[model samples]
Target: MKHHDLEILITTRKFFACDAESTEEAVKIATTEARKHLGQDFYSLEIRDPSAGWPETVHEATNPEIT
Candidate 1:
């Protein structure tokens, strides 16, 4: 069987405070929390940087294209 990589994107509605020291840490925490909340099967996750003070953050998911 062939395997493909999956990507997941999570965006927050507002700027939330996090105890993480860096963006990577923050993303990891957010991803974990989101996964638990989502309760679904996923492969990989990517976190996007927030716009200066902007609540809207862009997240992207990539997966194998089906024909």
Candidate 2:
């Protein structure tokens, strides 16, 4: 599979350059990073694996035929 996508929910929405193999794992990492950076005040988080059917970030990758 290709690189995964991760969303870290905090005071402001942010994306982690680090990617996990699965949603469960992604959340784990996000939580850890959040705790370290944003402290325990983080609101929520999201994980998207394009290989697992999650939408791509740039859009075109999801529909390569468009370009």
Model 1 TM: 0.43
- CA RMSD of all predictions: 8.6, 16.4
Residues 1-67 of candidate 2 have per-residue lDDT tens digits of: 7998876433454666666796667666766665576433444444444665656432111122322
lDDT of 2 at 3: 100
Scored by Cα lDDT, where does model 2 land? Answer: 0.51
Tens digits of per-residue lDDT for model 1, 23-67: 667776777666565444444445556653544444544333421
lDDT, residue 65, model 1: 40
| Clashes (N, CA, C under 3 Å) per candidate | 0, 0
Cα-based TM-score, every candidate:
0.43, 0.39
lDDT of 1 at 64: 37
Local distance difference test, per candidate?
Answer: 0.55, 0.51
